[model samples]
Target: MKIISAGLPRSGSTLVMQMLKILYSDFPLQKVHGYIEPKEGQIRICTYRHPFAAAVSNARIYNDLSDEHLKNSAIYIRKMAKAVDLYTEDGVTLMLRYEDFYLNRKLIVSSLVERYGTKFSDMLVEKALEYSSIERNLERQRVYSDFAHWDSETHIHGGHISEYKGDPTSWRNYVSSSQIQILVSILNPVRLRWGY
Candidate 1:
């Protein structure tokens, strides 16, 4: 099956891509920031994060907390939201949440395999499950320093996850009430659709 993985900038797209690569070693998987037109036999897997968290991460990464930044992030979140809704109707496409993928890798992988008729090894799934922990990724970063820089360092902005308290909602601590209002104003519709 042809697979395309995409998400908003700070979403866990790379991690999902790496995990899928491990699960299906031979399949050619493409990762993109924007939507791709999936061909007849292709399946597009899209990932998304809570808009509040996404907006905060965007600000931190771009180092710009202006209204412009929030507006842009809100727009991207809206676009991905629409994409997920349309893509899922095709039966071949699957929408995965970053939080769910992080907290339940095995179940998500199994569900995707069953729903999409994708082939994967149980043994590889087990190994991937074991390696899904943040500790494992952190260790990988230590051993392969370049892995930290392989994608956007926004995730490990401080060169370490531990520094950010490592919680998805940690963005709450950084984003102000007013700034959150800005995000919510633009994202409320999409956020509600995603059950956020």
Candidate 2:
């Protein structure tokens, strides 16, 4: 199986990937390339890149893809979902929801099985089950750190998207305009699909 942690930056994708790495320390990964090549019979994944790589590399639509541009994020999300489905038909790219994923580990596994076919082995399923239980609280850190700092420090922001007291406004300064456009273009559809 190939589970892509597809959430946008500052939305816990890296944090989630870091936690998952603890469980699969033996796996060969490309953090820069955004890919993971696991052991034989083991699962592999490319968190942000594989899906957005195409868009990021050759983005004809350089706009923010904000509600102003995309107009209907839902429509775009469905389209992206269908595209991802093509790569995931045989389970090469499983869409792991970051929201409910943190809520219930076992239930998430059940859902994954149902969506990807329940034929996965108990061991692999167990690994998936273990994914949500890891101990990592970068969000909490981001929240705590946000208030303590001001000035130029805020420009180097990271970790959580809504850490600025649920104020996404801080993201405006944290992310570069160009990068913002890239992410909005790639992730708004996802946010729309996810109803974010």
Candidate 3:
């Protein structure tokens, strides 16, 4: 089946693309940032991260992240969430959580294959998990300095998903308490809905 992967920044969109590349070596998977019009029978797998963490990553990457920036980010995130939810309700897309994929790669693959009829194998899934491991991807960056520029022209620190000090809440270190409160206030609905 045809597939397109889209997500907000730092939501493991590249990782999802890498996993799909390994899991369905023959299938063409498009890695994109925003929505693309899928052809018939095409399935879009949209990835999402906790909004607070995403906002923190944005701040780290872009470095501006003023109050206005966060407000705009919240607006954009709400629009993205609405689109993902609407598409999912219509069966045109599947929403995958970055945290879930990182913690339960096999289960995510199995569910996709079973529920969405995507052709995939357990062995391939295992291999993809290993191939997409943080260490391997980081090594890739080391060997090919160009790999540092994946989704953006500027260098992004902490490109590795596992670089968060072994804690999901490590974003707290980057953002201030007031910023966190603002992010939480803006994204509370989505946080509650997504159980983050």
Candidate 4:
């Protein structure tokens, strides 16, 4: 089976990938570039909301497909779906909101199993509990880092979602209001749904 473990960098995707790897113990996974290049038969990362990547695509698509553009007043959820489809066409996709897993992990694992079937295993679930047990996820707050170089604003942090109490806002101290808005606009929906 093919597994892609990336989805826009700051979306708590790496933690999910690690948890999956630790849990399944059989995941031959690969991290693909976000829109840099496409490689077949490998799990790819395509964060739907990262500003830099999104900006690049918006520019490219607008430049190329601008002729067929839809009106600005439209909600355009289909466009989002098409983007997801373009990047996430085959195999199993594991794009867990860091906040969701942080707030409630058991539900997340079970839901993933229900949606994706047996791709998620008991051992992986067990290990997630082991790695993220409340205290461990707290340590991750300090494990995160970031940079603002205009082309991209990347924040890298580590922790198991099972450990989080769903308060991803704690990371707010590390970024700016602008950053928070950007992340919230993209993640708040899933985060709230996931209970983080």
TM for candidate 4 is: 0.46
lDDT of 3 by residue, 24-125 (tens): 677777777666765686767787788777766655555556877776776667666665555456666777877777666675587678667877656777
lDDT of 4 at 158: 35
lDDT of each: 0.67, 0.40, 0.67, 0.43
Residue-level lDDT tens digits of model 2 in 19-49: 3454344554333222333334534332222
Alpha-carbon deviation at 105 in model 3, angstroms: 1.4
**Local accuracy of candidate 4 as per-residue lDDT tens digits, 92-168:** 45444444565566765675566556565576678776664555544544454312111111122332222223345
The true-structure Cα RMSD of candidate 4 reads: 10.6
Ranking by TM-score: 1, 3, 4, 2
Give the TM-score (vs. native) of candidate 3.
0.77
RMSD in angstroms, candidate 1? 3.8
Off-target runs (Cα >4 Å) in candidate 4 are: 32-95, 119-124, 132-134, 137-166, 171-196
lDDT of 3 at 27: 70
Q: What does the lDDT come to for candidate 4?
A: 0.43
**Considering summed lDDT, which 10 consecutive residues are worst modelled in model 2?**
52-61
> Which residue pairs in model 2 clash with each other?
none
